[model samples]
Target: MKKGCLIGGIVLLAILSIALGYYFYQQSKTDPVVYEFESPVYQEIIKKTVATGSIKPRKEVQIKP
Candidate 1:
């Protein structure tokens, strides 16, 4: 029984190692990213914003004579 259990553990570990190795191998086979850059073009960008609101003070001050 002990020998059987030891063999089973080793088999499980081997399967896990093989699966991880295959996964990493597949990952490494992926194509590298190739970027295409274009020359800079001059263009006008205009942004206009209008806000309508009244601003008020949070606290009021009192004057004593």
Candidate 2:
């Protein structure tokens, strides 16, 4: 019984060590993503109209100085 317990303890220790090593290896290969953001904002958005044109005088008025 003592021999069996010793063997089991050694096996359990080995398994734990291997699992821990694999866990750390995977962690080292990964980059942790940290996301920081602002809270929600409620407001009105105004829509603007874009026009392309040139203004011309309907009638040319001559001014004498």
Candidate 3:
């Protein structure tokens, strides 16, 4: 049947695509070229910050009014 042929073709295409993808992935992992550089030393830093008071949530209020 034509439908059966179409289905078979589609399945074959999917299998071939997956196989190619896996082959390329394996190839890349096996013959990989890596280049790394030494990073600069980091210096410790101390930062100071101050925050101004702003409007707060209703739950945070004393509600004495």
lDDT (C-alpha, whole model) for all candidates: 0.96, 0.96, 0.91
Q: How accurate is candidate 1 locally (lDDT)?
A: 0.96
Clashes of each: 0, 0, 0
Q: Write the per-residue lDDT of candidate 3 for residues 27-57, one digit (tens) a residue.
A: 8786567999998999999999999999777
lDDT of 1 by residue, 1-65 (tens): 99999999999999999999999999889688999999999999999999899988999899899
Better of 1 and 3 by lDDT: 1
Residue pair clashes in candidate 1? none
| Clashing residue pairs, backbone N/CA/C < 3 A, model 3 | none
Mark the regions of model 3 whose C-alpha exceeds 4 Å error after superposition. 30-65
Please state every model's RMSD to the true fold in angstroms. Answer: 5.7, 13.6, 9.4
* Candidate 2 segments exceeding 4 Å error: 31-65
- The TM-scores, one per candidate, come to 0.46, 0.46, 0.46
Candidate 2 has an lDDT of: 0.96
Assess the local accuracy of residue 60 in candidate 1 as a C-alpha lDDT between 0 and 100.
89
On lDDT, the candidate that comes out on top is 1
